[model samples]
Target: MTIRVLIADDQDIVRTGLTMLLNAQPGIEVVGAATDGRHAVRLARQLRPDVCLFDIRMPLMDGIEATRRLAGPDVADPLPIVVITTFDLDEYVHGALKAGARGFLLKDAGPELLSQAIRSAAEGDALIAPSVTVRLLAAFADSQKEPPTQPVEPLTAREEQVLIPVAHGRTNSEISAELHISPSTVKTHVAGLMRKLGARNRVELAMWAHETGRA
Candidate 1:
């Protein structure tokens, strides 16, 4: 199936660049583009694109507010959103997640990563780049005593081990190497972990890990 996406960014150049790059990928289409946060939300709600790529700053409203309105836990039925921005600040990253972002990406994360993030979000996964995640999360951790409140649940020892490295932005291949397991095994463990934790994607898993002081 073709993955439909909506791009929300204020800059014309950024919009054009993202649309062009995403359009070039197979099985992906830029269904709409919004010049500001409000329009992004309107277009997203109306179109119900598979994924909405949001920029943090925009006119009329900010991406964080728009994301919350569309995808927050209170939204009844939330759509998946992936935040895109040039800033890599911890506040922006954490705020985006709180507002119901499925993933966060640097504006310059490049075309390959951009494409990957869209597909991942559409598949109920998140594609956070390793480097950006580490810094963003560490800063978030330092500023908090506990992560945002989530339901209490027990996790296996093996899952706990897998969860920390994921918060540190380790990929399946890296986790496999660290735990001396195959990548497929890591994927299985990840899926199991998400199910147990009620997480939509890796980003939530990592966020919970950090929130729980495990990351």
Candidate 2:
């Protein structure tokens, strides 16, 4: 299936570059482009694309708020969003994730990683930039004075096994192969983990893993 994408970036060159790069990939199409966050949100709601690619520093709203409006916890039907930014500032990373962005990447993450992030988001998975994943999560974890919330029930041994790789940003297929389980089973465990941990998405689950020192 072709993955339809909506891109929001203030810079003309960056938007054109990304649109071209993604359009070149198999099974991916850049369906729309917006110059700012408000327009992005409007187009996204209208287009209902498979995924949204947003830059952090757009005018008239910014990507973080745009993401929150479309994919935040309050939204009954949250759309998949991937935030790409030139800055790797901890605050930006934190804000995007907290705003319900499924994936986060540095603008320089290159074409392959960028495509992978969009695909992952469309598949209900997530990918963070490898360079910033550990540092970003660690900083967020450290900033929290309270202990990580315990799961409503104890995790199974398999669930524990699955959590580590997920926190490390492994895809479901990767985790499935590593744990000698089927992809369906990996997804099942991931779902259970989310429910038990009160996590809204994989990103939150990853953060919980870091907070609890499981990652």
Q: Quick one: best TM-score, which candidate?
A: 2
Per-candidate RMSD, Å: 4.2, 1.8
lDDT of 1 by residue, 52-168 (tens): 999999999999999999999799988889999988787897798888897888888888788877876786656676776677556656777744755446777888898888877
- Model 1 spans with C-alpha error above 4 angstroms: 140-154, 157-165, 168-204, 207-215
TM-score of every candidate relative to the true structure = 0.77, 0.91
For each candidate in the order shown, give its overall lDDT on alpha carbons: 0.84, 0.91
Per-residue lDDT of model 2, residues 87-127, tens digit only: 98889988998999988999889998999999888878888
Candidate 2 ranges with C-alpha deviation above 4 Å: 144-148, 210-213
